[model samples]
Target chain A: MEPFRRLAALACPLVEANIDTDQLIPARFMKESRASGYGRFLLHDLRFDAEGAPIAGFILNDPAAADARILVAGRNFGAGSSREAAVYALVDYGVRCVIAPSFGDIFASNAVNNGLLPAVLEEAAFEALTDWMGGAPAELVVDLEARRIAYGGRDAAFSIPDAWRAKLLNGWDDIALTRQHAAAIETFARERLRAFPWVAPRTDGPRGGAQPRSPDAGETRAGGASPQSSDL
Target chain B: MPATLFDKIWDAHEILRDEEGRSLLWIDRHFVHEGSFHAFDTLAERGLSVARPDLTFGIADHYVPTAGRPRIADPKIAGMVERLAGNAARHGVQLFGLDDPRQGIVHVVGPEQGLTLPGLVMVCGDSHTATHGAFGAVAFGIGASEVAHVLATQTLWQTKPKRMRLVVDGRLAAGVTAKDLALHWIAALGADAGRGYAIEYAGPAVEALSMEARLTLCNLSIEGGARCGMVAPDATTLAALRDRPMGPAGADFDAAAADWAALTTDPDAVFDREVTIDARRIAPTVTWGVSPEEALPIDARVPDPAALVSEEAARQMRGALDYMGLAPGQKLTDVAIDRVFIGSCTNARIEDLRAAAAVLKGRRSRVPGIVSPGSTLVKRQAEAEGLDAVFTEAGLEWRDSGCSMCVGMNGDRVPAGERCASTTNRNFRGRQGPGARTHLMSPAMVAAAAVAGRLTDLRDL
Candidate 1:
């Protein structure tokens, strides 16, 4: 993950509200593993026609917006599904920042994890940025550390949680974030184990008392794992 | 201090609160599927074994075909499922692979196996993990990176979400279902109404829902931008889990039930926000546009862009109308569909099957229809009750259990330029397939649509 400090790049204005994850990158394109390149499929359905030709009218295919590194969208962008592939598609397609009035909770979390900045601006500020981009190719500056976005004599401040801001500045994945609270986590586990023993993992064996034993201790089959007849 | 069920679960799982108020929260149960293979790879890269493999469970649902249990022909999907099974084996984690009778959608299998108990904090690699919160748990989806974090440390760093309460009072009209309630709420509140909040569903209407119906409601919480949705445990909840194979028995069941009984919000507790809805006003809702919030009652006409107050709203309305190929003043019931899908974690339970089956008992569908149960158990139960026969007799393809057409990852899809009346959450563009138009509705309404070859109201049917 690269630390996000600042970027000044051409912005593509997509004024449609509720640009969900499915629209960003549909589920069918999520077949390949996370490491595979997803840029080709970013907004695949919307950007291409049935003949596999690029839809020239689409914003991403527009000659003027071809080099956009920032996307200015409407409210509630990324509002659906928890697919991190949405962020992967944007980042792989050279979109480093998305300026919106609001975002889906899970999508925003996934964005931060992938080093993509979801800069939330007020509705008026977001509209201003889009209006400016609609006129001509414009460069938008996003300063994460300063929590501000500026373009064409207009500037606005955004808000992000302190912890997430630190993670974005430090380029820290969740593993590194969790490592900072290792001692506290261990303490909590010990206390919880004693306080709620029933919630612990089922290490005593398979769930039911009458289930047949597995041929190998480590590999268990579903033969005897059906719900009881009475229960059904 | 009085705490809601969410607070009880969160406080019980909190390990530490940092200077920035982010807590290290412990995960009691972690559910994984084929989509989670990347997380396992991350753990291997770090040379870290699963910290608590016993608490983690894996299933092969996402890419597994719902028509048959044949070997997956797509190498990429096959490899992902194989990797999931291999990773689970190496870590001593239990896996329900393609051939397992227990293999099903992870959300359906978890609660069916009694693993998603009340007052536990659960996390899965899928956003619909909030389905488990219907059992009074604090559950939500985590990203792949967070998935890896939990696999390695059995904990996740988090910021507590503000709590909101939704009280739906009164009685639902006949033929209206939990799916309608969820769609109506999303339409009324807009997609981002629950953003940055954890929500609790309460009031007489929610309490009257069966456990499966409650699960259906919570399953769609993600569609509304909520972190999670929960319903407190009551007699109905206890009875639903009474003698499940994985649940407690004898004296243990008694003790557990007592604890669950106390897992309710205190009467005097206050929430960060609250909203009240009249259940009687809800109709059989259907989404007309890309967003779940763009829904209207089945009898309503397509919204006119001219009537919209804001330019942004009108722009979105025009875009949706263009993509969906719809016109203002058009009745939803008059909109023709190419197919019908009755499945997904949202409404593929045995009860949902019965509802659709009853509608299709002696009726033949004018258009093609597919029925995929939520789990193998659900499939077997439907078959035992001859619900599968009814569906097959009515020309609806009765298939095996998995997330069939809901996510379109299993090769089941609606063709381009075709419309479908579906029972799954999310009517987002290309959600079912590329250029596929989806109208979100309940299972019964989907059955009615299959018969009418258009979006038809169940009440009219």
Candidate 2:
């Protein structure tokens, strides 16, 4: 993940509230393996027509907004599904920051993990940013360490959890963050194992407690695995 | 101290609080599925095995085909399943593959096998992991990075969420189920109402629901923007866990029950926010637009954008209506549907199947429909009670357990531009398929729609 500090980039304003992950990247485009770039499919359905032609009216397709590296959307952006692909699409498409009134909990976390900044602002501040975009190039500066977004001498402050801010400043993914608490985790695991023995991990290979020769042992040749006749 | 149930659980699981007051909380149970194969691969890439494989369980739900899994026609899906199984094997994690009798949706399998217990902190790669919070646990979904984090270290770094209590007083009307309750709340309180808060569902109506129904309610908490939703454990919850395979037994069970009794919110507990709904006011609800908050009662007409409180809200409604191809004044029941789906973690339990079966007992479906049970146990139990025969006779396809048509990443999908009445939690645009319009409803309502070939009120049926 890239380290996010300060960036000044053109902003694309999409004022629709509750912009869900499904709209960010449709399910059809998600079928391909993760290796294939998702940038082409970001907002695929909304950006293209049935004939696969770009819709000129869509904001991203507009010539003026074509180089936008910051996206300004309405409240509750990324509001459905836990798909990190949404963030992948945005980051891959060169979006460095998303300014919104709020975000879906999972989507916000996924954004940080992928080095995309989900900068939250008050609804009025978000509206001010979008309004500014209507007349001129909306180039805004986002300073993560300072917790502020500024444009044309107008400054708006935002708030993020101290931990998330730290992660962004340090360019740390969750794995690295968890590593910092390794000793505490080991101790917690040991204590929890004794406190809740019933919840221990199962070593049973299959239902019968026998390891099968095939990795797909329980799976049938065709229609997948079927229940044992006795159980059925 | 008078702590809410969420606080009680979070405080108990705290390993260490960071300088920022973010706690490294221990994860007692971690559920993974095909979607999490990447996380496992990341762990392997780093040469780190799952820190506590015993605390982790994997299932092949997301990519397994519900109808004759048959080599999973999609190579990508096939690869995911194979990878999930192989990863689980290599990491010493127990996996419930497609053929495993224990296989089902990860959320359903957790509770049915007695793995979900009171006061246990659980995490899953899928968003609906909040479904486990019905057992009084502090459970929520995490992204793949967090999944890898938990795999390498059985703890998650977290900032405590403020608590909210949604109190639903009075009894629900006939034909109303937990799905309706959830939809009602989301509709009343907009989609982002629960943002930054963990919600506790309380009062008479929530307490009256069965464990399965409670799970349905909590499962949709994510839809309302809640970090997680929980119902305090009581005699009802204890009775549900009595003899389960993974649950405590004998004196241990009694001791656990006694411990669970103390898991409720203190009588004078103060919530950061509180909202009360009259359960009697709720009817069988359905979403007519692209978001869950766009829901209305089954008999209600689509909302007029002019009636909205703000121009921005009105514009949003107009856009949603345009995308859904719906008119503002159109009656919900007057809308025709090309298909119906009755399964998902939200409403695919035995009780949900029985409700759908009751509606379809002697009736035939007027359109194509599919019924995928939540888990194999649910599948077998439905068959034992002849619910499968009822569904099959009604012309709905009875398939094996998997998250079919809900996430639509699997082979099962609704064709583009088609309208569907689904029992799934999400109603986002193209959730089932590109350009596939979804109407969220209860299982019985889905059955009613299948028989009517259009959205219909269960009360009228």
Candidate 3:
């Protein structure tokens, strides 16, 4: 992932609230390989008609938005589905940052992991940014170090979790970071296992453990009772 | 200070807190599906293996074929299932594969197999992982990157989300269900209302819900913008967890139940936010637009954008109405549907099947539809109860389990411009397929739609 410091790029506005991940890339196109690029599939349904022709009126279809790298979106952007492919679609399509009033819990974290910034501003600030966009492409500077978005000589403060900012700025591999606390994790795991044996994975073999296969679907178990059905 | 159930679980699992106050919390359970294959790639890129493969379980459902058994007709989809199996094999992670009797939607399979337990901190790559929180678990969704991080470290670095209490008290009317309550809450509160908070569903009506219904409630928490949704464990939770092939047994089970019983919010615990609803007020609600919040009661008419309070909201409503081909003041019950789907992580359990089946018992559906159970066990249970016959006799296809039309990834798609009455959680544009419109409702409501060939109120049926 590219380390994000500062990016001043052309921006487009998609100010529809609750723009879900299914609409971001659609479910059918998620199987494609990242090597081939997910850019073309980004907002595939929104950008095209049933016949696959690009909708002339769609903002992304405009020539000015052809090089857009930032999106000023509506509240609760990327609201449904935990598909990181949603973030991949944006980054692959050259969107480096998204300014919104709020974001889906998982989508925002996914953005940081993939070097895309999820800049959260107040609803008023987001509205101002979208108004400035005014159905036309504009240039906005997203400074990760400064935690601000600069547009038309006006700067708006944005917020992201401090940890996410750190991750994006350093382009750090989380696994590598966690490994540094290996000793502490080891101790914690041991204590948890000792205290809550039932909480541990139901396994019968060595370290990697055997598959925790259950009884056949036809077999009835004697120990547990199914919940007394209320109406089912 | 009084503690919330979330705080109790978070404190128990926190290994250490970083300078940012982000805790590296141990993950007791992690679920992966076909969408998680990307995470495996990340693990390979860094030359790391799953830190606790034993705790992680894989289910092949997202892209697995619903009609076919072991044979996935489409090569691309077949590869997805194959890759999942191969990944589970390589990691030594237990997989409820395409052929496994336990195979179903990941959320459904987790709770049924006793893998999802109270007080356990769980994570999955799919958003509906919150479904397990009905058992009092602190379960939430993760992205592929965090999925990979959990695989390699068995821990996640997360800043604690503020806690919120969503209380639903009073009596729920007949035909109203957990699905209705979920949608009703989302409609009452904007889609972004629960953002940055882990919401706990409380109050008497929530308590009265069956385990299955409770699962349905927590399942759609993400739609309301909650980080996760939970219900503190009670007798109902204990009964549900009783004996599972994977859960502890005998004395161990009793011990665990005691601990789970203790996992409740203190009476004086203060939430960062609280919203209470009169359960009696929620009717059989359904979505009228793309977003979950864009819904109204069955008796209501289509909303007029002209009457909306804000210009942006009005504009968005206009777009939704345009896409839906609905005119303002049009009766919601008068809307017609092309097909119906009664399945998804949201509403595909055995109880959900029974509810739909009860509505379809002797009546034939007016339109074509599919009735896919949540899991093979759920299917077997339905078959044993003769519910399969009810669905088939009612003109609905009694298909096998997998995500099916809810995601439209495995060839079960709603055609272009067709409107469907679906029990699936999402009603987002094209969620069922390209140009497909979906109406989110309960399984019983979906069955009602099937019989009426439109989005009819279950009460009307």
Q: List the per-model TM-score of the A chain.
A: 0.85, 0.83, 0.85
* Cα TM-score per model: 0.95, 0.94, 0.95
lDDT of 1 by residue, B276-330 (tens): 9999999999999988888999999999999989876787789889889999999
> CAPRI verdict on model 3?
acceptable
Better of 1 and 2 by lDDT: 2
For DockQ, candidate 1 versus 3, the one ahead is: 3
Candidate 3 regions with alpha-carbon error over 4 angstroms: A203-232
Alpha carbon lDDT at B23, candidate 3? 94
Error of 3 at B253 (Å): 0.5
Model 1 chain B weakest 10-residue run by lDDT = B242-251
lDDT for model 2, please.
0.85
lDDT of each: 0.85, 0.85, 0.87
Best-fitting candidate, scored by DockQ: 3
Report clash pairs, candidate 2.
A201-B54, A223-B70, A225-B99
Interface RMSD of candidate number 3: 6.6
